[model samples]
Target: MAMFSTGGFAQHGKSKKVKNAPVFSQVVYQGDDKVYNEHPLKAGEFYNPILQGCYPDPAITRKGDDYFLVCSSFAMFPGVPIFHSKDLVNWTQIGHVLDRTSQLKVHDTGISAGVYAPAIKYNPNNDTFYMITTQFAGDFGNIIVKTKDPFKGWSDPVKLNFEGIDPSIFFDDDGKAYVVHNDAPNRGEALYEGHRVIKIWEYDVENDQVIAGTDRIIVNGGVDLAKKPIWIEAPHLYKKDGRYYLMCAEGGTGGWHSEVIFVSDTPKGPYKPAPSNPILSQRYLNPDRANKVDWAGHADLVETPDGKYYGVFLAIRPNEKGRVNMGRETFILPVDWSGEFPVFENGLIPMEPKLNMPEGVENKTGKEGYFPNGNFTFTENFTSPQLDYRWIGLRGPREEFASVLKEGGLQITPFPVTIKEVKPTSTLFHRQQHNNFSFTTTLKYVPKSEKDLAGITCAQSERFNYVFGVTKKDKDFYLVLERTERGTSRVLASTKVELKEPIRLQVKGIGDDYEFSYSTGGDRFVRLGGIVSGDILSTNVAGGFTGCLLGLYATSANDILVE
Candidate 1:
């Protein structure tokens, strides 16, 4: 949050006439080189949403002053994006943990049912980093992935038998390991809807298994056993001052989302709920919450080298009337433990735009971890040797199919179905970070058959998206546009086009409005269609837990004939 230098107020009374002066920008660039540049807040103040768009269920750990973070990527391949921060404010993506297809099995799964909360921790004793997550769709219940060097690569996976989701590992001071996860309700426990419990198991690291007969319910129901909370999941255990603290999110993932803490004297606990439950939440503080930020919970606390505590949580900045197009984002808040319990800044209120920076932290601009400053345009000229990590595919790794053409631009081979088929659909896309921005790409292809197609897509999920492509019907080529919402897709607009060269497709996002346009290697362009509510590409309308992924796509919806 940098502010530009400018004059204050000029006299404008009838006695003295004021002249219209040229307004100068008052924005300033701080940081190492000004890597992240945006003036939505005051100068010298940092903004919330450390990581933007669809980065939910944050899990963070600090090692020797270096902070590494991983978020729930759900169906997005190369899942569990790993980010590193020096000061905890400026973060840069080191790489992804699940970068290979063999490492994950998300094929044919819904966007919301793929990957759940992942926990990343470092065991200093063994000098190994472990990441554990749940694949809600596949047979793998809870898996652990370890790495010697996080930037280099990670092991395939060691599957752990767990009945529920959001599994996390914790090591005790005596070198003993334990796993805490949500325990699914059994047959007779039909007391309340979404009735779930948090349980712990002895983790045998060498054997890569949860010790049998050691399972016990630590915090049943929730902080308040009387209320019978639903979905008491995303459990994480932390130890400090000889007291084991379990942090978890309860009451679903929507407006009632909250972060609560329980304390126990032993690793296996008849844990006691903190007197002041919901250590961090913004679910009920704001009156005009529909238009502002809402739903903040699922937190992981990290103690900095300076002994200061900060918690990372997931929140959503609703664009309009409770429509969360950007999905859940990662936000950081200062945790002051000088009191009886941890109290977030502003004391259980909705997060503010500007927050106090960590002590002795320097603001670095144009840094690798921060967003690129100035322009918001991204173009793949295809001159580069390899595809950037920003481009991600459906369940499998994009490189297994998608390739860069020697001619120019990206080349995506056909899967079986278009965006209509949610699972196993071959597509590549990037998150739409800004509400008002333009995404354009040039497709270099000639339809071998009428089924050959490639173009731009704005996807909320596999079942819901807007694809603007150029398809061939026999000898003629036409601009094809289709919109799908909740498994229902209709061809909104299609027009003929004669192209002797590569055709450029563009999608402009203006708040809730989206306009599609195309051009054939010239300044003149044809408006395919527009005025489509961008909210239709939002999670609120699409009924999923993901944000809009707008990027290039090419699919052979029919099938490739095998020789």
Candidate 2:
């Protein structure tokens, strides 16, 4: 176990002075799911969701034998989590692509308003990797960053001359580069609510800019304009056997989501949609089917070293209550590119829980340094100089408020900002990885006033969340539980307590019910608010692109009443 202590202090807007700051000793997360426990992995089978828990909008690329994959991070600091895989089955998080505050400017934005649909591709012409995405906040619309070696560091963002989201770069075989993205129809060409178009521009490789006059519409209104398709985004241009292929995600990111393909003779194309249409989808399947996986789309394809093609896409697995709390996850499926256009092998049908591993590749997941799937447990002691990549902050970088104490443990300097505000708060967040899980942390501190509080926060966004912590009310110390749903906050429970030693706080989720508990000295914990509904922590109810976040939170502007 590690220990922490605070020495220096400062005052900020509307915050009161405090004597002792809160110190966190450790955090442990354990996943216990009935489905995963019953259905164990066989000899040659692996899990379907290679990268689980809120890792959405996957884009993949390969250079020689190495494959690099990236996912959308929204407003989480150090945006665009990147992963490395030798075999498509096993993956390891190398680090984030945007790891600096100068490169990521989402400081005052909402949790779900920063980065959207990041596309990563390798351009062999210059031996560099390009990551392009739209920053909905910070006024940095459609930016691109380059890195010669992804293991090192990335360049500062260069704003692109585009007006839309999901921008992707493609380097043709003849050394010419082109950029394709999702944009709205020209001026007044709107046919329906979700009517969108795919546009292409000739990119200048030397100047890193798209030619101003070379922009044109590639696929208008998706597969068939007559049907008026919705959200034709995440476009990628690929060339094989003297033909240019264009792929995109259609139908919104909801139940009707799917992947469609188009073909043309040139990069700038009057592209033709494939006759088979939806190359990948789970929309038409039975809703109550076993091991349900829905909302599958936003796919990127890559050819493995052995010439076998596979696609990394985003999908969701709802709980028994038919609610999505874990958010969209990264899933891999073998692609059958031997046909005219690439099609996800088992994509159209009801998705299975396991997939057959590639030839001669052993499943080293949950062992080695590879990312873990299925049921697993993660514990952090906060003793090392560098924090693990799994721990991240919201809106701003974690280093701005968190420090690993010289003597050990982690110290979070409380900010005046609370979790209810859109600004960055003094909180370190980790994604809620499982529906049935437990998160526990031990804290050592005593509140000086009612304005100070430190504990755990289970947040879906600023408007929908739960805060449970220790606060000073009147002349006594108390533990309080507050619930915020759709912007309305109310204290669910509160109890006076004596602060003589470190206290253990925990939150457990069993299906749609969530319970908060605490312990003072021993392992026995008393439940604080009984079982509360987790409906607000779900995307279906919270209305956002992100999943729930488990935050080690501390704030000087605490407002939960203890009456």
Candidate 3:
């Protein structure tokens, strides 16, 4: 994770070697000076999306020594998967607050609609953890749940009189609180488009009601800010040194179109954009190293206990075939101040994937497992006793997707579900470590009958992804790599590799590219293609927390033979 120099472009199979990485060696003296270095004055530990699979909009709150972060549970039963972190990195899934649809009855919610941007705020006054979300379909409403402890049962979710999506709550320096969100102006008013008038209003946290009426000032991204460039949505308010900053993402949440920062002095006012205004455009996500172009701008600010500020924005690491990202990933940057202004000294900076460790975690030594010869490795038994934060699921997660084998190896069952129907199921995964990194899995594939491909996927979304596996077409086995991008499939490579025995699959992913090969003998590796690279796309285009992921996937035209 430490860059010795701001280095080169590509360097062999290990493209994970970061390029042009700036070393803040001067930071050794700058903090005491008035003007800090523009880039990485003090880079906190880098945070990879641990809850990668569909965990979007991570609202993090710290209470005492415990840190709580939750993501939107879109259409998942256990709506909001709450996570606990300390030192703000290396998180483990504690539990989900909304477990039953009974308490969260969004029957009318679309296939992928349920909980929207939930701000987790712990009120120490009564020691109550308050969770609020935009209930998109049931009544198209705002709801609140209160619990003395998050791990315990939550009280009933009381719907607010508000109507909108991506709802967030801002509790001021004073005990005064307010719930702010953009309503579907397209639905209610003159039947205009949805991005028309995005406004902010006050709320009564005590009574779980709206203190301000529908007539609130349009903070940004209405006809006014909308004219600037990008669609203004997902607004959150923060007062830094008396400068009330209302920050929101624009240009929609997909592609490099996202404008990270547009600020305002008043919660509702002539909100101004940061000079670094289009604060975090993905124009810099190098096309060669990153497969997808660039994207992931929806963001919120988080300040550490040390009063250091950082913006948690999203980024996409593309896969091969150049499909856009399927999910958005959470990225961080340090903010330098120019008088009262919050400047993105490093927001647009391409974060190198280095390991800046948290202060408390005792272990920095990566766990060992099966790895070819590289910097990254995957163990049979996960080094982390629980689960690695690097892994994320579609929604929350379930134990059924996998379980720990008693023999000290991770025994993965064939989860036949695809990206569309996995339903937050446990399909343990890790972010692609490099624009190019090889992922190989040695397993025995026993077809239940025919038409089953069990293997690994450089998967972004159900539509935009690829997999390499063994399929029994007519009782004959063939090794194949199927590219599934935007609901279409083109076989990249297929061969009649008879299954006289079990085989191992290897995937070598380089900057925006990959190679899928099969090893029946399991001694040496073969090149499936001439170094197939992927696009820089990720699920962020599809909307979720995480970059493009190298996930283990298995599917069956019929049932699969367990091996």
**Candidate that scores best on lDDT:** 2
Model 3 CA lDDT for position 408: 26
Q: For residues 20-53, could you state the per-residue lDDT of candidate 3 as single tens digits? A: 1110100000001111112221344433433333
Residue pairs with clashing backbones, model 2: none
Two-way TM-score contest, 1 vs 3, winner: 1
Of candidate 1, the 10-residue stretch with the lowest lDDT total is 4-13
* C-alpha lDDT values of all predictions: 0.72, 0.89, 0.54
Sort the predicted structures by TM-score, highest score first: 2, 1, 3
Residue 371 Cα positional deviation in candidate 2, in Å, after optimal superposition: 1.1
Task: Return the number of clashes found in candidate 3.
Answer: 46
| Candidate 3 vs. true structure, TM-score | 0.69
Off by over 4 Å in 2: 1-19
- Estimate TM-scores for all models: 0.88, 0.96, 0.69
Candidates ranked, most accurate by lDDT first: 2, 1, 3
